[model samples]
Target: MQFDRKGLSDEDLLRFYLAILKPRMIEEKMLVLLRQGRISKWFSGIGQEAISVGAALALQPDEWVMPLHRNLGIFTTRGMPLHKLFQQWQGQKEGYSKGRERSFHFGSGEHHICGMISHLGPQLSIADGVALAHKLRREDKVSLSFTGDGGTSEGDFHEALNVSAVWDLPVIFIIENNGYGLSTPVSEQYRCESLVQRAKGYGMEGVCIDGNNLLTVYDTIKGVREYCIREQKPYLIECMTFRMRGHEEASGTKYVPPELFVQWAEKDPVKKFEEWLLLEGVLTYSHMEQVKASMKAEIESELVRAELGGPIVPVTTEELEDVYAPVPEVGTDKDIETVRQFSTSRPIRFIDAIKEGLKSGMEEHSNLVLMGQDIADYGGAFKITEGFVELFGKERVRNTPLCESAILGAALGLSLEGFKSMVEMQFADFVSVGLNQIVNNLAKIHYRWGQHADVVVRLPTGAGVGAGPFHSQSNEAWFVHTPGLKIVYPSTPEDAKGLLLASLADPNPVLFFEHKALYRSISGEVPEAYYTIPIGKARIVQEGSDLSIITYGAAVHWAKEYADQHPELSIDIVDLRSLLPLDYDAIRASVTRTGKVIVLHEDTLTGGIGGEISAWIGEHCFELLDAPVLRCASLDTPVPFNLELEKNFLAKSRLATTVDRLLRY
Candidate 1:
């Protein structure tokens, strides 16, 4: 009940009261609608409206916000149309996400609101990227994000805090430390006494506030916002309160102790604020009721409009249309246009090709940034970015903490600000720790909300080195199954450079798989000028009529070596540079030329990308076959460490035998 006005005028205080009351009223009505089978579900913020309303009011108009499901006040206060929000809740196409996602799970760029995903942690890291963009642009804007007590347990939470602290990003991480995460209590969430106290571990300042007090909440957040912009420092604010309702409408409050509810009931935020306003003579009881009635009437009007709005129109073609932004230019021969006469080209290493492409992108696009562990001064595990730190400076060539999810989220955040970012995973296997961000957030974001994650993830993949299973993994299959992600794997240096440049140009997320074994082992004729090989296109590495070998990455070398060993047996080698939108024309053309095909890859056979390619070929080119498609891939077991065992496990051991058998058949 005790608070400071913090120089806020009486008008501002009255505005905060209305802002807080509006969401509370909406939530109350939503519960009624949910029971009537109107909307799918609603996460009610009945008691926690103060934090959202206060934060929205305190932050600058240009600053961005990432809020959770329960914080509807943030959206309502930020000028999101109540009709659109209600329509969104009703699963309408006119809503923000076009009925793809419901229940406050979609972001609105117009309102500077990035809605929280179910995962709850990527948003924090993404906000870091947004702040990074502002800092780089010298816009002096900050990014704000919200999470519940349960979210602090996620690795992304720790990673986000550490990365933001290390970078000194202007981000405010607010934790609505409601007593429980779902049914679990804060007692079981973390051993720390207070969540705000943990901020010291990350080397940042933090403040805990009475979340139920509207004046205190707004004053505290306003101070933090000013501090962050003035000092360009990350800060943490723990808003201590209770979730009066269950996690959702369906989830009851049986687990909550009766005495705890009784204790919190005395501190009902809205009632207490109303009492204060009356005691301070800000308004009469009649005026307060009139104000509340007007707001209620507005909500009812919007709700009726929302109900009248039609549901998502089920158009089969429209469903497939907007999955990717600026949908990739597939199958065009972009390579031949710029670089002709390969005989006069210069030989460049595969690693150098990536470096060259990155250099070119940086020169062309001032917004492009590079981030990864040990990539700045150490030049990465493969030394692909050697001397980049001095050339590009530390800001552009950033050495991030070992946080894959955080950096990927940051890359997506950068894209929101018209900046392109390339994130490097020291090894392909490490991406497993952050696959959720890639598959869920980055992949579905464009489809869900028309936000392009213009990010190119450099995954150093494939086996054949002495690295154990953790370091060497051909996990492209995981992302191949995931839609909205562009997968590019190049064999030769020229393709690596061109494909990388093209991937950079893409608006969607691109997984640039750089074969570890081929980085230094192979060299190819690459042009110096900037050019791009069209994504989703295949190249004929060696043309012949006897049999066809379709492969990519290091396996391309293995197939060629075997072909050179046999002079009598003519072979056609097709290197599929892009895997997502498989070059069906090129795949069928090579298969038709020989009527025999051998699919070769270094990835394990089971659930490999080869299965998809072979299945497509069987479905499309079944009549063109002289023999059953032979897939020469590594065994299903873990990649071995021994050189001889690795050779036996790799496709090289099976390529010769499979090719001869197909040729003889």
Candidate 2:
């Protein structure tokens, strides 16, 4: 049988080998750099050089590559300088992995290298998302994410691959079968004979190749890339490579069969590629030697240049300072400024405001969609989406399965597809179920990639009603602790409408905390025309220099009621619209002016949002405070079923009492 291959030009083949060989050498040098304390840590793509180089060279410059830690050759082929790559390991400012990223984490905004995560399996899912985005945007770009055979064990790997196949997304999942996953061998990792066979489950074409052969790697990936463009199909490339080194420089492969390492090393990619290039007249022996010398010299030069660039300025304690976004202009317009007037102008309830905001946002931007348990025809538990189905149709306002992970995960997919998703957690307490999807996945998506996951998570929080602990509990503190998540808790209808609209427009992932107690009871005016209060901004419900009443959600009203009664003890009120990006500026400024402070929240006093606010005030305005940051929170007990008992157990009117006590302080 004769096989006809549209082979590469001799010049191209030589260039490819030379390009790869240098990075392989750099990989070796990086190990030494690691040991010498010049570099932090290293995940050398030693035996898998050909696979990395080939896939990188085969893809178009505009096409995206989401590589793992063990794919330095891919980085090098895509013009990531050795010094910068080294500087990354050395924890230098010049390193391409941005100062914020870990040593193994790498990629470039300029090169279209969409983030390389150290964690296994999820890269392919993100790459699939990026590919989906490309398709929607009508951009001719393919997204490739590399992983090891071990990563195939992860559920996300299969989920992402099947989704890609179903959507006909242009993604190439490269499995560098390097024999072992840390201490575990492939035999232990999977029962399957080869990783490529797994693709059959997803109904996609799969290929296995000699990963050590640079020519094979290049031709295979190039063929797949061409086929993907022509067929508009996803692919699974299983490169049967070896791992000459352990997972990282810190670990040694002592447990590996010595003979296995010896056997694979004999088939070293650099030498194999050189031999094939020479056999095909692609390069002269002298040319091979020159390439090696050039690579060595180039790497050496980069090391020196990188060293001269200086060590990374460690992110100081002060630098992690001011973590939140600029205080959103919550009441930017004069009409929206006065809370009492805004409330009286139109008595729209909290649930009504949520429905109105979703309707207005959807009407304003076709990209917005609402999803959650019973949010479609059932109109949510609070009947927030009562008329949404009739107005927006089933497609825009959809119901989801009970799987919190699945619901949040699908929202992630939809958001990546450029649809702004407003996902609601049935209750604030149930948010714990989907917390991983919210914090680990969605929150960090933007910071991880230079892209944004514009999403709004509407969580019904607070505990004054007799719903009990299981259903009636505030969990805002859980999210405010997470940096990338934006937490917004509005006290009234106008703020709810404005903040929800603002959250829809904001680039970051927002957690809109709606108090279940306030849903029907709390009513305020909403504007006829569409308007948005900026996120991270605060509302001074009242102005007084005597004492500062800092609170959010249902507690805002309690503070206001108390302030009205005691006209002598002046109280300055700050209603934090957003928690994660808390209005620290407003809090600091209010404390500075009033000289007295009281932090109040509905959750338990043990570790509620009040502690965070108090600590922040102590950090920023401690000297100005006449009294210690006074906190008013619910007793550290589960909310009871009795309405009166629940009210006493939670921090409903506690803010009013705390204000009275603080007046004496």
In model 1, what are the clashing residue pairs, if there are any?
Answer: none
Off by over 4 Å in 1: 327-336, 339-344
List where candidate 2 sits over 4 angstroms from the true fold.
Answer: 1-5, 153-155, 158-168, 187-210, 213-235, 311-347, 359-455, 464-472, 543-548, 558-572, 588-597, 616-628, 637-648, 653-665
How much is the lDDT of residue 15 in candidate 1?
87
TM-scores, all candidates, are 0.97, 0.82
Error of 1 at 277 (Å): 1.0
For 197-263, candidate 2 gives per-residue lDDT tens digits of 9889989999998888776787888888878777878999998888888888678889799999889
